[model samples]
Target: MHAHIALDGPAGTLRVTGAGLPAVELVRAPGTPADAHTPIGTRRAALLTLTVDGAPAVIRPARGRLLRRSYRVDVRVGGHRYRLVPCSYGESRLSRDGRRIGTLESSGDGRVSDAWDAGPTPLDLAVGTALAAAFGTGAAPWWETVGDIVGELVAP
Candidate 1:
């Protein structure tokens, strides 16, 4: 019950598609604030607020400024904060209050791997997958996250 999400075409705009989720459109058309619009995807509700910090990419030139951005995605749902911090190359650790919850790992072909424990509910899984997209890994399918969560819950 893992999710494998990959980015299609080039960079700049967030467009992703995977198993159980539809194609996610992260930003609005063009000439809009990167964080102005909400992310739209299959089973993409219950996500209260999604904020992004640190450029996930190495160098992103914005507004005449060449900034080195690291992906720091903060997702909030029902007052719980789920943070994704870049731990190393091709890997981001998702945690809550310094405790590990899950991990979003990037593969060689730009696909993102999402895995979590049984503690998180379906809503949590939804937000976590969104966090991956919001950060930069691209959007994963909804069923993948849900399946993983259910599997963990059923595991011994």
Candidate 2:
């Protein structure tokens, strides 16, 4: 179970590792139509558990090394050819009128890479030319293109 999350810091501690690292384990998609643990496509990558005002977010680590800006693809796993650490698929938020509208992240291994959902249409310039044409990676945002660094804060 172990899904808490409450780190505000005073005693100082915070390591809610990427995408809600609650013991790390959740992989579906034998057919995956959802319900296998929620969160699917449309920026899929689940694990969740981050409250804050209601408490929950208290893990640790990341007092130093936690760079994590790396990007890669090509995944198979189990059957071999594994490289699947696939993540960044973070989509959830939109307020508008209250002001916020926008969010959408989608690195692969979640399988849907028609060249990473094919590009261009203001999704931060097709997620910055689809993360440099699907993972040669690096370099975007010169004057805004590469869809604003893959749409900056991760598209929407």
Candidate 3:
């Protein structure tokens, strides 16, 4: 299945629409800082919440390498757990039980698109779209850049 996500910058909301799934609206949790300074492994993490089929789903930062630049988030919906692992550029992989189920691509323009395998249910699609909209096209966190510079200076 395919889905399109549109983000509202001022309202801090994301709306996802697709063929098979009901429209999902994700709102950024209040007081949640932006991911630039709240990368994975940080004390403060980004959070987005949505409802799917009358059940609530939450997407929040998951544990990851302290020095890495990409963002990682754990999604819980419909009694299932999924992980979003973002790579360089604007690509991310969605996995469940260590198996890839979908891919999300962000255009870095308040728009994200996703393609999912047939095995994913509508709830999964909603969660995936929320993840893409929340963390669009990862960028190096400020601390990561500082760490890189420190490492380079210490290298022999």
Candidate 4:
């Protein structure tokens, strides 16, 4: 099952509420073809591999999601209502343009949840967070004080 949640912070605000699991896999977006022996489709993927090589990780989970070391949250964000969703303690990796998004993780499941106290954030922020989680700075040294993403996800 899918859900709706939001992440609102001083940096920005965003919402991730959608139903149904994305066809993409937890390891990487599905059908992305990441055999270094072969060619992958995106340069961002290569950069992510280079930038996030061997970074430390600290991940927790929202709701009942797994909250353990070496584990991150797997969140799919979107929806017209309640615009933000955070996985409690995973990291985000945005795309080059800062639009497309996806996430890399050590471990965690659908533990993402909305911050009921603060309420939800704007839809744009939700998208941005998802973007960050997917392929933006969260994937780079700028933010990888946290996780390891073996593959790449794209911008929306």
Cα error, residue 54 of model 1, in Å, equals: 26
Ten-residue region with minimum lDDT total, candidate 2: 58-67
| TM-scores, each model vs. reference | 0.44, 0.17, 0.66, 0.22
- The residue-by-residue lDDT of candidate 4 on 1-156, one tens digit each, is 343433322212223445432222112234444422111112222222211112211211222212222122223333221111233344433222233233322111223322222223343334333433332221124234333332233323
Number of the top TM-score candidate: 3
Error of 4 at 16 (Å): 5.0
For 48-84, candidate 3 gives per-residue lDDT tens digits of 5666655677666644454333367776666677888
Off by over 4 Å in 3: 30-47, 63-70, 115-120, 138-156
Candidate 3 similarity to native, TM-score: 0.66
Q: Which one is best on lDDT?
A: 3
Q: Which of candidates 2 and 4 is the stronger one according to TM-score? A: 4
Candidate 3 clash pair list: none
Off by over 4 Å in 2: 1-65, 70-102, 110-123, 132-156
Model 4 poorest ten-residue lDDT run: 50-59
Candidate 2 per-residue lDDT, tens place, 100-155, comes to: 32332433222122222332223222222222222222222234344456777686
Model 4 regions more than 4 Å off? 1-31, 34-108, 114-117, 128-156
User: How much does candidate 2 score in TM-score?
Assistant: 0.17
Compared with the true structure, all predictions reach lDDT values of 0.44, 0.25, 0.63, 0.28
